[model samples]
Target: MNRFQAMAQIMAILCEGDRIRKGSQKYKIARKLIAAKIDRMGPEAAYSKAKWNKYELFVEIEELLKAEKAGKILRNYI
Candidate 1:
């Protein structure tokens, strides 16, 4: 993928629910961006970047999943 796509994929993986605040509108938007990028790059490639360990990426995926779950229940809109 290109640089923008690459960065988007990385951001999508690295972001956490706590960072976005689960109940906020930002959380809902971030969740969608994460899902789209993860779908394009595949979760493995999206989370695993240079110098990052597999376990770390795995943790990121877990966090993304949590964000996804929280986003589903959240009703806020941008």
Candidate 2:
């Protein structure tokens, strides 16, 4: 999934429950995205054998989303 979609999923989880703190939002989203990808790729596909990973990609997105100055929620909005 794209970064926006990934972020959307994380936001949804954030609003879903108090059990999950915002600090773990990235991990939650990464797990969810990986599961979704595995589903789309078919059950035969295994994450262990995958050549790429989402956590690294999410790290890049997090850096981009960091505020350069005064900003809240989203840094760059389309």
Candidate 3:
């Protein structure tokens, strides 16, 4: 998959882990770690500008899952 698709997969995995680990401090810390990884992958300014859009993130997650189910290796998205 392409860079955007890969990153979306990583983010979706992180989100799932966060949901599974809810109510623990580890989940909060993992979220920050995932956010930092994403920030490092792209232009920080652009990422910061779009980071508040939850709907976009959700859509990206859906796309990522589709990619994953199609037998695409998406670990590079991280």
For 1-78, candidate 3 gives per-residue lDDT tens digits of 444554455445545635425544444443444455556655443244335554455454555556666777656553
Local accuracy by lDDT, each model: 0.51, 0.44, 0.49
TM-score of each candidate? 0.39, 0.33, 0.38
Q: What local lDDT does model 3 show for residue 52?
A: 57
- Score candidate 1 by lDDT: 0.51
Off by over 4 Å in 1: 1-18, 49-78
Q: What does candidate 2's lDDT look like per residue over 21-49, in tens digits?
A: 46665445444544564556643342332
Q: lDDT order of candidates, best first?
A: 1, 3, 2
Candidate maximizing lDDT: 1
As for model 3, its CA RMSD to the true structure in angstroms is 9.7
Could you give the C-alpha RMSD of every candidate to the true structure, in order shown?
10.7, 9.2, 9.7
Residue-by-residue lDDT tens digits, candidate 1, 1-78: 654566555554444445445546544555555556456666656556412653454454455556656765322321
